[model samples]
Target: MKKIVSSLLIVSAFLLTACGSGNTNSSSASSATNSSTEKTSASSDANSGASEQEYTDPSQLKDSYDVIIVGAGGAGMAAAIQAKEAGANPVIFEKMPIAGGNTLKSSGGMNASETKFQKEQGIEDSNDTFFEDTLKGGQETNDRDLLRYFVDHSADAIDWLDNMGITLNNISYSGGASVKRIHRPADGSAVGGYLVDGLIRNVHEREIPLFVNADVTKINETDDKISGVTVSINGEEKEINAKAVVVTTGGFGSNEEMITKYRPDLKGYVSTTSEGSTGDGIKMIEALGGQTVAMDQIQVHPTVVQKDGMLISETVRGEGAILVNQQGKRFFNELETRDKVSAAETELPEHYAYLIFDDALAKRAKQVDFYKEQGVVEEGATIEELAKKIDVPEETLKATLDTWNKAVADKKDEEFGRETAMDYDLTEGPFYAIQIAPGIHHTMGGVKINTETQVINKEDKTIPGLYAAGEVTGGLHGNNRIGGNAVADIIIFGRQAGNQSAGFVKQ
Candidate 1:
């Protein structure tokens, strides 16, 4: 996603703040910095005469290779690692100038079940329960086998990342999960930043050559089985051959044209994904005899400010915030999943609402401060003043708060039915408000892949010598994707794609 460029003053601060906050800046630029350094060092360590030919002149890539992987986001990186571990020297090609895909811009943490992290906190979570929650969250439209694979293997994926050096500690109750399972990095940085950096570091240690700026344009194949790919490097076209190709290129959320084609209802909505997420892998593979599923099931998340579509993290509501309409009254419960909240927001009179919280609630969730800094938040001294500032009737707003405060005092919400009850009173002065609307956040549709991570072709059969994972492949998530499950979808299947592709090559 493009940063909302401000004056020079904020740019300098954003440079340092990007990695820390999920609000502004993307980790796409950082990949080139460390990747180039590590690639240089990895090349130098190879045996002198037997060292793999450093890619340049298109002529050198004419020969065949063992395996080729596309995309360098979480799934792509995980695939590269697993492929290497399976004893096949794999070459990775990332389209962006730097390789971290939209995975670097994500704010929500990953989902896992029955991990030691959950046990330490004594949270009762099971893979079966997680599976049922996933099914219910998707409205039971998700592919049973694929959902089963993701649920059963999610804990192992978390352990895999931790063993590879990405440390996830904190757990939060994500909207769709039955119990707490969203795991954040222990350092409090954006999970995308930590996960990307950790995977890149591990790639370097294994001496895998991850070529950045290698924009894969087409899949070169013979008789429809996997072969190799054609990439544009520095405006020069080069074709490289491989026995297997893994397509981990992410979704097309940022592509306005695709959004219009698939879900025309989301045409006017802004997106929160990176520019490189244009569904390249899906398009390229579709051109090569692959089929897609769930193309119409796009997920739009509510509570993202309209200007640049930057997220106002769900913490605001989780901590203690109420969403009110122009009539100065609460509508849906704030803790509802993205799909439910977005639907309610879309049906509103203005197709938007305001999230209001007290000063104490702000103190607990400090990320709201970033929204304030971005000038997207409205502040007021009292409830009536806030109602006035947000164009809601003073008396109506006052009555809403009166009932809300009474509910808080009574420890029961008779209004919209917030089951968590109230954590803070609205009586505190210095109220904050954020005007938000539903926006295109994630694409729940892409290439179709089975439980084994094999890409299915147009004939409804698994494509030989080809595999896919991450947002590039769909069907794991049916109509709506739960918050933390995306990270789970990418890594769990990314590892599986790698392992499967390596196994194919070995056969």
Candidate 2:
């Protein structure tokens, strides 16, 4: 991690010297020195496996452009692609060496309404129903207008990706909805990465420039209006002017400082989001006089692999799996909303739970196979063996299993109201157990944006030449975020922000 951090610092220094307008001689010398240091550090880190350096400084901006998209994640890429398609010269600035932010690490599923897949499956769904489901799932804290816009436009966004040569498997999975609306990409990675790939291809084809390894530290303003950005690269400082700037730098899921301060409950907990999700966009936008919504609300995924912080999608339970407590007792309903399930599980003595399954279910379930392939699953031929492998109590597990078997035989999952008589009992000696904990997944709050995807000030006024999308701009997810809604939010709002930005530039 140190090596990675040092590499990032060196990359930042190089970018600063390459882009900034600092003192010419000093800047050149600093750039060379930083380049040498970066190479040495990167090599050393590679050999020693130290911590990666974090590039926290903002890179100097170019003199001018029609659009500047920060963070290269799903939201940022979508916004940049839309802006360029609308005849605007847009550039994407990424702090990491790689373009895909948290999007790449996602399960590649998107939530949309009234898609062709839903029509084929005979699952009756509509934008209105989608809106109602989102509202209910979020406990009514979400911005109704934004939710409506997201549902109304999400299908089109899917179609737009299809037009751009990105393929969806035409399957709708179940989520927090009356009907199945989650769409998955062919590769089965999160739809965010696929979105990033499509947008990146388009960006390259159009010759849109992307500045990787460049971090934006601050948003520069002049007289209460947007101006440009300030960044440090290669140990030198530089500034760039821009006509419009968009903050798509994602959320602060990985920032311990922010998480501890704003969401103390999640502090020291594991997160599956990328390392770059340190709330850079939130900090930058807030510093620019933007007001954030639902800052205290962070989504906690119910089924993440507790050992190495791997995300085990809730879809596993949707298929057929049981969550058991330390006492070896099945707890909540398997199919309940994440918030309810997480809340229930957290109340347990250890604040830990294990997902128990048989070999047959493991093979059939998407999540189990995914993790197994990733080498994160532990398997055993007996409950005792499984418990020993996972370091749980053998007697406790056996007792729990015995109680559960009785419940199954009686056709009553009384403790958690789970549906009775799930086929394929745990009698199979070769059983499996995966430790799970509530991990930070998403932040339902960020910079406030209107329906047009325009960044709004504390007074609810639009910030001219400034826009935000994705996790950076909140109000889409209220107190809770529905599964697949995050993908919908990024694509739908990203496109809107792009169109709005281009329209503004034209005027």
Best prediction by TM-score: 1
Pairs clashing within candidate 1? 1-274
Backbone clashes in candidate 1 total 1
- Model 2 C-alpha lDDT per residue in residues 1-507, reported as the tens digit of each score: 232232233332111100111111111112223332253221100001122223322332356777777877778878878888899988777765546666655663788888775676686789998899889888988898888888888778878878888766544444466566777765343354456556666666566666665677788888876777865444445676676888888877766677778877676777766656778888888887888888888888887665555667655554446788777667777656679888988999898888887776655454455566556567889889888887778898888777666766776776766552254466765788778888777777888999987788888888898889998878888998888888778888888888888787887
- Residue runs of model 1 more than 4 Å from their true location after superposition: 1-65, 187-189, 359-366, 381-385, 393-402, 405-411, 420-430
Candidate 1 structure quality by residue, lDDT tens digits, 1-507: 012111101100011112211122222323332332233211100001111112222223435567788988889989989989989888777755544667766665798998888899898999999888888889898999999889889888888988987878777666666567888776333466567767877776676666655678888878856789887754567788898999998988777778889987777676767656777888888997899989988888887777776766665665568889888888987767789988898899898999988888777565666566667788889887888788999998889888988888887888777754265777777988899887777889889888888888899998888899999888887888888888888899998988999999999
Residue 186 displacement in candidate 1 (angstroms): 2.6
Q: TM-score for candidate 1, please give it.
A: 0.84
lDDT scores for all predictions?
A: 0.74, 0.69
List candidate 2 stretches off by more than 4 Å.
1-62, 170-175, 187-192, 233-236, 358-370, 373-375, 381-430
Task: Give lDDT: candidate 1, residue 496.
Answer: 91
